[model samples]
Target: MGRVAVTGGTGTLGRTAVCALRAAGHDVVVMSRRTAPGLATADLLTGAGVEAAFTGADVVLHLATSRGTADRWQTQTVVDAVRETGGTARVVYTSIVGVDKVPSSYYRTKLRCEDLLHASGLRCAVVRVTQFHEFLGDFFASQRFSPVLLTPDVPVQPVHVRDAAAALVRVVSDDAVGRLPDVAGPQVLDGRTAARAYRDARGWHRPVLPVRLPGRAFRAYGAGHLCSPDAAVVDGVTFSGWLREQLGSAALT
Candidate 1:
């Protein structure tokens, strides 16, 4: 098994991927900007210590992402560092399913990073996935103090982070690379339904207000841009199952 280096190993997805890789019997090294234990100290933002982090890595999972347009710069830095080392590593990047369809700034930056990797002259795979269950949970969390939970009126398929990580593990071992198929959870539900399920799972009765804005991003979301029902390479766990696991089976009552 070759050494695998994961950037942003501290992030939710990154951490799950690292565990999956290790479980698959690959030697894994975690690359992070922080000086934490077991992390190969590296920063994609300033391009510091990346070379050392990627040293001897046969496959690099470039899962490190930041807010705004920082990915454009961080991605370029990754390309440079990998190319400088003869470009032997295969990069399995984690991208969102609706990056091309969504006009949001974050999605656009992810698309740009995908472009960079494609032209970087290294073996790479752009694996797009739908929103994670935790991401939706975070959205609900953001509205915790609100009197009413406002959810976008659109369909969502939220995959578990572990499922997403397992799909990535398959991609890492596959010889084929570049623009891989999308991956997502097993169930699709409207935002209202999802929010209600979340509320029920948490044993909380709250007013779920469904809202639709006129923005292109919202419209795109309403059109199911966040769903990958047709193109998923890996069909994963259902949202209800994930909720049950997190909140326990009794919470669903």
Candidate 2:
């Protein structure tokens, strides 16, 4: 098995992918900016240590991402580093579903990164997935302290992080396929429903107020820009199942 290097290995999705790759008998090296015990140190923001992190890697999983427009710069740095290597290894990337159609700043930057990969000259595969279940929790939990939880009334299909990680592992193990099929959760629910499910699972009685925000981003979200029901390859686990797992784990601690 060839060595696989994963950037952003400390993030939730990254960590899951790292474990999946390792379980599949691949030599996995974690690349991140922070100095973690088993991670290769590299900062995509400043373009530092990227070359060393990618050295001798037969498969580079570009899992690193940034907030807002800064993602463009970070992705550019990685593309530059890969170009310098002159190696023909496969570079698998994780991207959000509907990034090309979504009218959000983060999605736009992700689309730009996808473009960079297409033009980077190296073998690459872009695995686009819907929002993770944990991301939905974070979205609703942002205003937990407030009397009412304000959540957008847009549809969301959240996949489990481990399911997405397994799909990525399949991509890395097979031949490089550009722009693979979209991955999404088995169930599709609006933000309010998702938030309520999460709250109920935690035994929190906080009232969820669904607010309709008027904007291109929210409009796109309402129009189902983030959902690809027809083309999506649904995972087995549902959002409720994921919530139960979270609850079970919390009970142990």
Q: What is the TM-score of each candidate against the true structure?
A: 0.94, 0.92
Tens digit of per-residue lDDT, candidate 2, span 1-253: 7789888888999999999999999999899888869888999888889888888888889888879877888878777777777666688988998898888888988998999888877788998899898888777667667778787898988888888898889888888658888888777788788778877777776798898987888888999888867644454577788877877522100
Error of 2 at 147 (Å): 3.0
Candidate 1 residue-pair clash tally: 0
* Model 2, runs deviating above 4 Å: 231-235, 249-253
Candidate 1 per-residue lDDT, tens place, 29-65, comes to: 9998889789899888888899988878898898888
TM-score for candidate 2, please give it: 0.92
Q: Number of clashes in every candidate structure?
A: 0, 0
Considering every candidate listed, which one attains the maximal TM-score? Answer: 1
- Candidate 1: the clashing residue pairs are none
Candidate lDDT scores, in order, read 0.85, 0.82
TM-score quality measure for candidate 1: 0.94
